[model samples]
Target: MSLTPGLRFSRSAQYVLLSNVAVPYPARLPYANLRRRLNSSSRPRAQRPRGSPRTVLRRASTASETKPAHGPPAVSVPFDPKSPGSLSTPRDPIPPESTLNPPATTRPPPLDLPARGPDVSQFSYLFRLGKAYMQFYKAGVKAIFTNRRLLRSVAPPSGTASAGGALPTRAEVLLRARTRHDVSRLPVFGVLLLVCGEFTPLVVIAFPRLTPMTCRIPKQVEALRRSAAARREASFRRLAHLRAARGEKAAGAADGKLVAGHIARSLGLTSGWWDKAGLDSPFASSVADGAVAFLAQDDALIRSGGGVGGIEDAEVMLACEDRGMDVREKEVGELRKRLEKWVRETESSSEEDSKDKVKRLLLNHELLV
Candidate 1:
């Protein structure tokens, strides 16, 4: 049977970049001065030393340089807008070199002018609200469209079996879905489906002892879809297989046995039956019994007298390997190829040794324990 294609994220990344703006740079202060006054009053006249010719000349030179005949002092301090209090400090007779260069003025934040109306604040607020509403409307419309598409995809195509007819196996539906849809065109949609498919086997494999009566059904489809889609896009987990197993458990919880069975039946999971089940976070024997009950209901579909057809257990297992509950189509073709090789090897074995080769192999791998 054909395998599903790999999935990828869509144009949604473009909107992510558009939603935020960059922060503005801050301003700096220029040429500032600090001065400390000397207490001349503390020194008594009797304690003062007599001035020599060298001291007299030095004092004269400093006085002459400090006050120029023209305009202002040669050394000027720049004004600071941020802290006007600095202006109150007295200047020292000899200022630091920093006083020569004024600090830069702080620039005001960029003015965001409103596109409409004389009252900019009012206009800006209204504009933001309008954009928000438009975004909400777009999201709602997109969600409706996506749900409709998914429903159509899940439903059998023209001339296929009706709702109550003998359901197809999970393998058959997947093959058909792969053949009909340009999975690449579906963007993250394909990945979401893959994740949903992956969940079943992961749960079976990872938590074989836990059974499945205690998983919680997810309340948010969007969250589930987005998560699955993201996993497909970001295929870098070290233990992807293990992660998929956990996700499947979550999916089982989200899709109660009844709804899940109905969905499975609709998708043609003929090998199974749907039974009522309950899930809580903690493990419970009662919940396992509930799962057994659901599986019993699916027995009718499994026992229908139609031929086993083209699908096989290996195919179903491969689908689980590929789609896991976290990532859709992340490892689809790889698992399918592996299963196909196993099938080929099984077919080549002698009649006496037909001995359920897949089952033997799974046993060796501890996959079916």
Candidate 2:
């Protein structure tokens, strides 16, 4: 048997640039579209009666009658075969050629085969209804895939209680929806097909490789992350004490009185500022030096800087660090000398957030753990 041509039809018949022949319109004749007759069929609409055809199954038409109307004409031609005028006369058929062919088909028809006729029973209403239902079910399955949000209403809930519990996160809801079927709980065949149609195929195809792959991936990722975090924590611990000490005395972090308070808090010194003889004295510098030693050991003392600690509760930690040296120049006179020096140093320091760095240093040193 000859192969069918791979040609396709199009309703829009724009001129093709590569070929000389213009193809038919996607519907039918291409020229018909140019004349604005797009819906025209082989038979015009008016020729048919108003009612549509009721037949569900169209009977196959018999093949065309190809026999000639009359027997072949006996032509009488008397002309030289070499002359141009010989084309005007008809050539007679060869007697041997005509006699070689059989009167009908070359092979006999199969008599044993059942005859084909109009089978009214096959086209009965019940069969048509069943066919329609099958078509609808197939269409419904396709619709489920396309409109996936419908699955959310039908997904099986996990909790034991009939009443709703806490709402699931967006991630949980979306993940559950992928395999959920609205029909899954229905009284249907085997109850498995009642599950999501798409979910069924996924379980069949990917279940072998998918389960093991999913299990291994998160474990590998978590272990890698935890090990890296542990390494970083260890590295930071090594630097915390050094960084805290350096930050306190690197030429101009805070006034001597302020440092004294930090030191007294870290060393648990008698909540220093007891009277006029308190933080103002020259001995405060020595107390401050001692404070920086343990400053990295406890975050409680340093956290008293900007966020917590009260002016009234001197027992907790001092809050005067926020005060500019100008206010304490009289009580802590040495601050005047350091004030100008501190400004110059602060101007020269890198523009990083000093407060945040100090906070991190305290936490790393187990000051705020």
Candidate 1 structure, TM-score to reference:
0.19
Residues 30-51 of candidate 2: C-alpha lDDT, one tens digit per residue = 5646555545555467764444
Model 2, position 339: C-alpha lDDT score = 30
What's the lDDT for all of these models?
0.32, 0.30
Estimate candidate 2's alpha-carbon lDDT, on a 0 to 1 scale: 0.30
**Alpha carbon lDDT of residue 124, candidate 1?**
73
For model 2, where is the 10-residue window of minimal lDDT? 101-110
lDDT, candidate 1, 253-340, per-residue tens: 3434333332222222222112112222232223433433333322222223121222233333323332222223345444444444
How close is every model to the real structure, measured as TM-score?
0.19, 0.15
RMSD, each candidate, Å? 33.1, 38.9
**Model 1 superposed RMSD (Cα):** 33.1
Could you say which candidate leads in TM-score? 1
